[model samples]
Target: PGAAVVADAGAREGASKCPFSKENMAMEGAPTADGLLAGERYIAMNRFQVRDGSEAQFEQRWAQRKSTLLQLDGFRWFGLLRRVPPTGEAPDFEYPDDYSYVSFTIWETKKNFNSWRKGPAFKEAHGGGNIFSFVGMIVNGFMTSKGPPKPAFWRSMLMEKTSDEKPILRSGPGGRPDADGQQTLDPEVFVSMNRFTVAEGREQEFEQRWAKRESKLDGLPGFRYFQLMRRDQTPDDDVNYISMAVWDDRAAFDNWRNGDA
Candidate 1:
């Protein structure tokens, strides 16, 4: 369980337009503009690079400890995504042999997640050095947790739900319809995770490019769902973004990457 926790750490010195509550200096207590619990809805992406011959053991260990989080409040759905090799042509990015796996967990609220982090369960799961003992040469990358800058950002940028007339994807554990009606991951899907470090003062430009590309990507073969996330910025950290796309399989993903779509 090589997990890195990500969450908003309150306002930065220069970001006067930070969407979180200024009065609530404590990150755990800060509230969203909608008056919902601070960090009420969040997603944590924990990426791990597993050594050869330890894939089965790493997955088994993950399964055994997953139950610990299930008992915790605010814990929602969790998906363990494994990187698959491309069948045909490869994508623009390199897919190394040392396969990467990412655990994406959704939390009902940030406070509950924070509690889990501070509690004994979190310590035993992530701090016991068990992960290193089982999976050699692992690198964990923690993605965004602060969510979008505002509620409007989600409406404009995130994936929407299927209509009543349309067929829905197979749901997984802790998977629930969000306020915007988007469902979680389906079984047997291939996931593409991309993290971006935006150039300072160019956030809007990056978002615009993403929005434009998303429109084109939506029509591509095997495309399932897409999510764009903004990581919470602390005083010492720079603002970053992460995007995830689910496809039917590696072939579908490869097709989209190689074609114009």
Candidate 2:
């Protein structure tokens, strides 16, 4: 553990001399030293704000869909997450959940996403959507969306996997139960993500600060996973990045926040 801390510090200092700043790092194909990501693992999430009482229908929409993601090349992981509310007077979170749900997906590279968009799989995936269904859903107030979807894409810079994924957690339909298709809702997993827009030209310094900062998240109870990532944007665009953590449950996160860690 101490050795890891030392190595992380050394990397923080050495990154400036390594010639690859987060800005200049190449973002393409797998497991190589590019940016923070050892490989070209890209993440995409579409946040959707489902109106009150439409949550079930919203989730069912995804659960009932015919997925072609597995058949596509470079598709890695996917998860449909629902925001969890605080339990039993856990002093309300300073900031409440943003969107009601997020469709999280991982790809081998940015190119793979483009390929999927142009290929037949993408078309087939949306083949069932028609104006009639859209009109009906809107008119019937079924699964009404609160707002337009907000999409965010990122390249992972760091991650800590505390438990075995066997690929990923209880996500979409036909999930890892392996026997019965009917899996329980979202498997006690809670995702906490924060967005950061660093000052211009301070991207490297910001990243270094994160690399060197001391954190006691390693062995925190119920901590399952964590990742620091930089979003895809123009150099002049806001230097957006995200720090995402996955816990055994929301209560676990609440404990960490309630405590000093």
Candidate 3:
């Protein structure tokens, strides 16, 4: 849905434990791209950078595939976002950037998400009911030579928004992601995110800085939603944080960037 609300940030743990992961990915915060954190609600993204001309094929995989997340607990929202190529670009695109596609998901809690990961639904949604699908693996390697999915996760710190409506789910045929079960987002909406890595031991200081800063985005045109997300971290980890903002379109974002607050 285009509309979203500021969700409550309930009891939080300093260092979240691993729910069911085989190995931790040094995720002491920027939130493990693929990890379990201690929190009430979690946002995760699996970013993919396919070969130069393979974007359509990658999206097709998600569009045609079946996801059983709605049937699983802790699931709240899922969306496939495509990066808008830099403006003023011609046939040859050159931009030092991140993921070309992001598979976004929202969960009620970290534990619930880990549970689903270890459940049969994980296997089923990943194509077939196999732990390691050799066919899928081969295809992934051959298709995404650019890079594999980078998992980035975050816990909602502040959810300032333009609306208070929660995501609405309706009945659909076989509960397909593209069916009429979910609300459609405006085609022009855009999301912009920046990754920050704070020096170790200064995470709290960084957060305090953000909390105390005066933001001028409240009344901006085309602004839809904003979030400050943090990751699970250990003592030795460099704190990672993601600042995300949702706008009406790419032009809106550019306008904000070109103007002074």
Q: Rate the local accuracy (lDDT) of all candidates.
A: 0.47, 0.56, 0.56
Summed backbone clashes in each candidate are 4, 2, 9
Better of 1 and 3 by TM-score: 3
lDDT of 3 by residue, 1-261 (tens): 111101112113332112122432344434233332234468766555545555544444455555678788888767667666555667366546544566777788877777877788776765475544422442344234433344566686666676544334432224344433133333435788877877656667766777777777767777777777776544222337778887777888888888885
Which sections of candidate 1 miss by over 4 Å?
1-41, 66-73, 85-99, 119-157, 161-187, 211-222, 233-239, 258-261
Over 111-144, each residue of candidate 2 has an lDDT whose tens digit, in order, gives 8876875676655554444312322232234323
Q: Give the lDDT of residue 248 in candidate 2.
A: 79
What's the C-alpha lDDT at position 74 in model 2? Answer: 91
> What's the lDDT for candidate 2?
0.56
Top candidate, metric TM-score:
3
Runs of candidate 3 with Cα error greater than 4 angstroms are: 1-40, 86-98, 134-142, 164-188, 216-219, 233-239, 259-261
For every candidate in turn, the CA RMSD to the true structure comes to 11.7, 13.1, 10.0
Candidate 2, residue 188: CA error in Å? Answer: 4.2
Collision pairs in model 1: 39-110, 40-108, 40-109, 77-174
Could you give candidate 1's per-residue lDDT for residues 22-63 as a string of tens digits? Answer: 422223311123321122256655444444444554454444
List the lowest-lDDT window of 10 residues for candidate 2.
Answer: 1-10
Q: So what's the TM-score on candidate 3?
A: 0.68
* Alpha carbon lDDT at 21, candidate 3: 29
